[model samples]
Target: MKKILVPFCLFLVTLAYSQDDLLKSLDSTQTEESYSTATFKALQLVTLQTTKMPAKKEFYFVVSHRFGTVKDGFDSFFGLDNATTKLGGIYGVTDWLAVSLSRHTLNKMYETGLKYRVARQNDNFPLDIVGYSVADINTFLEKDQYPGLEFKHRMTYVQQVLLSRKISEKFSLELVPSFIHKNLYNPDIERDNQFSFGGGGRYKITKRLSVNLEYMHNFDKPDFYKNPLSVGLDVETGGHVFQLIFTNSQSMSESGYLTNASGDWGKGDFFFGFNLYRVF
Candidate 1:
């Protein structure tokens, strides 16, 4: 609730901006520059379920720090690795589609992805939902393991759909059904090569901010596998978006982080991360 209060207060502050009263003052006068300013100002006024509310063009950069054990070296290194930093980017095209590229500086692995809002054309419900697909190539891994097995070392792919509906002014829910595939699998080490399901939600405290929670469950194996649950917040100010969040997973990439998150929230292994979004 502490997170909700700050933005709710800011929402109230926007109503009274230096005696201009942004909510009450509107210059109905029409001009080329006036229409441009009005359109931008209008879009900036609304809080959106999907980040893809229309824009001339959109660009976002997200940086995060992880304060938990690195997944790969946990068993061999006794899990004493230092915390790591990661950076990511997102670009919007035509307001219906967006492309993203992200990488972790620690291991140099990169992920390229895309998100497209298929049915955003409908006006009744905001954004209906969004669909995103990602393909990850683990550059840190060896190119060839077994002899003549070069084809098996290709990149992994994950596809997910984020469906959300606003229940009320202060409440919303999202459902995410996901699929993950690995071109190369090790039988001795146990990995999933099938589909998965997840869901998430948002609760708005004001017009410009909201809290988020999401969970994903894998149905392949039960003994060594665990589900991932995350809680985060989204805040919008002018052209900037801030996401402050905490979660049990720390892998940083969609394929590495979301699928293979081994940290347990009950064990006090959660970490803090922030996403900063800006457009030009």
Candidate 2:
């Protein structure tokens, strides 16, 4: 009986040691990957783009309106009577890719664009980076207005690289380097290519509200054009977001606002505007 008991005890000790060794090996081989998210709450922060993208299969419908300059005072109902509007929709094809189409009333413009997340901020990354490109077609121009207008001349292209960082729970900022090309340009006044730098930021004031600001400076703006500047507030309500904005730019498209904005904020030449976004 003693001999049988000694053998069983030895076997039990060996099994316990083997199990411990196996657990240590599994722990050594295990790896964990980390990811960060939500650098911005919306795809756009006022007139500037953000690094945010919708989840796969999600859709967003946006309606934007910019009224005439407040210089008209109450005569134009604070610019509401002479408003330019845009209707747009965005869809997420994948977790990191989104496509959008929009129509603007100002130039009777049609725009199509896509945005991709190149990289995201994580424990190992410093900033979130995104790539965006758009093509705009001006359909309102009549052949009679420009005697030699061609089909290709009506198109413009814009590309941008967005870099964003969330410095704190309440603050976020982004920088954009943009290139714009117009197929047709006025030989005496306008150039075919333009470059601009844009900066925007958001500061959270509450759980559902934030203050936003955006500015774009064109390096080769014509004498008649002024840089664009916008300030606004973002109010979130579940599936909808309402943006109340004041901007110097009358045009809503990137090609139009970045290069052709003519108003000055200091001179009370800014327009009152708002953007409504509904997600489905």
Candidate 3:
């Protein structure tokens, strides 16, 4: 699936209209309104979620791929030898509510989540507030390895509140306060309930392109687990958003990235990945 999906994403890039053509009307609309539009072009920013949802009844398909640490250089084919893939679909049940389902190859993880826009950054509001609830199951755990494994041991849940603002015409910022619950975990390493604070920003360099940066600080992570930091570029072309990222995170799920990020940017321990979101 990784082989096919990765190539398919690249193929779509070739068929998209030039960036300039898609943003021709960008300058024509300069009226400042209380409710912002296109604060972030995509629904995601690297490893973080953005305060954007599809239109009512609209659907979106997303493909994400993360390669191994590039520190090995040519020894590991620049991380191509060990790659992980995630495939997901999202649907907006209403203009303010969305639900998503995803499967990640790592840990044989399956995740489902709901997003609701509780508040919009309008004249009466100061920010765009979105609430998220997600749950995931890890099917990779083996009963043989753990003599006493239960269904609950494989479960994890996450709750996050996304607060964001379009600071200016060319900049947008978001803050994510996340609460993670693990049904089973190692006491020696961490606790069952964990909290992390994350911040991300998008600086528009052009109407169709922007630079994004995200970082998360886990207050309860073990010493060995480094904070996840991701920097990427979002290329918007009509119904598709292509993201090219360099991140110190190997996991695509919220629980995984928040507490289990294993890479370190200082040592060049980072992965190269891309996320392709297509509107259907």
Candidate 4:
């Protein structure tokens, strides 16, 4: 499934960029100045560049699809039940601030969260950092229960300091220091809390194409949860960007990172994932 999704995501991303190129050529009235700022901001979000970066003034929508290996309930179907889906959006609140929200579909359970940028940025400093946080809720249910069990919801909070540093015109890197807390999600799992450090790098393959990779490490006892490390690549041709990735962790959001990760960092239980983004 991961192999199939990766190519499909890239195909769609390329298609969107192609459309953007056509619009740029046909609309002679549109000024490059008007679009330059927003385009750069959108690219930053997709690329996850580390450096003081400029923000956009326009509203943008992003829809991402992620699929991984089958982890549970094989009789029902091998791994078909393990697929995850996310739909989200980010808006430029100002030239330096942006906010975002997203919802994830996890089989029968649903997760939702939001993030906001608290810091402003510029180009000379090359360290575009944002203060961001997220809160997600997951409800538990049992198949053997009476017709339908009352939802016992669990909440998780995550706070992070996001920093991006541009090493050069073609190279950039980012570091994320994050804290996560989970509750009512797992009673036996006494240590459902964690602090994590993450880093990502981007290399431009061309003006419109780039490669990116990211990894996260948890600073806690390994017995409680398995630390997750992920790597991915990004391709931006025009208006659309394509991301192809692989990781041992399956948790999709901050809350999942704290409590739901089940993959061992040393073992080989990883799967591939992809993100396809298009702007209108």
Across 6-31, the per-residue lDDT of candidate 4 in tens digits comes to: 77459545744654344454444544
* Lowest-sum lDDT 10-residue window in model 3: 15-24
Candidate-wise lDDT, in order = 0.58, 0.86, 0.88, 0.54
Q: Residue 214 of candidate 1: its Cα lDDT?
A: 73
lDDT per residue for candidate 3 within 74-163, as digits (tens), equals: 999999999999999999999899999999999999999999997666544456789999999999999998879999999999999898
The runs of at least 3 residues in candidate 2 whose Cα sits more than 4 Å from the true structure, single-residue gaps closed, are: 1-33
Off by over 4 Å in 4: 1-57, 70-82, 107-126, 140-153, 190-192, 221-224, 264-267
What are the models' TM-scores?
Answer: 0.70, 0.87, 0.87, 0.67
Which pairs of residues collide in candidate 2? none
Residues 1-280 of candidate 2 have per-residue lDDT tens digits of 3454476458546744544354454345333234455567888889888999888999999999999999888899878799999999999999899999999999899999999998666544456789999999999988898898998999999999888888888999998878899998886988898888778999999999999998888887898889899999999999988999999998899899999998877789988899998999
- RMSD (Cα, Å) for all candidates, in order, is 11.9, 16.6, 12.2, 12.8
Superposed Cα deviation of residue 88, candidate 2 (Å) = 1.2
Q: What's model 1's overall lDDT?
A: 0.58
Candidate 3 lDDT score at position 166: 89
**What are the clash counts of all predictions, listed in order?**
0, 0, 0, 11
Question: Which residue runs of candidate 1 sit more than 4 Å off their true CA positions?
Answer: 1-56, 69-81, 121-127, 143-154, 189-192
Clashing pairs in 3: none
- Which residue pairs in candidate 1 collide? none
Residue-level lDDT for 118 in candidate 3: 77
In candidate 2, position 137 carries an lDDT of: 98
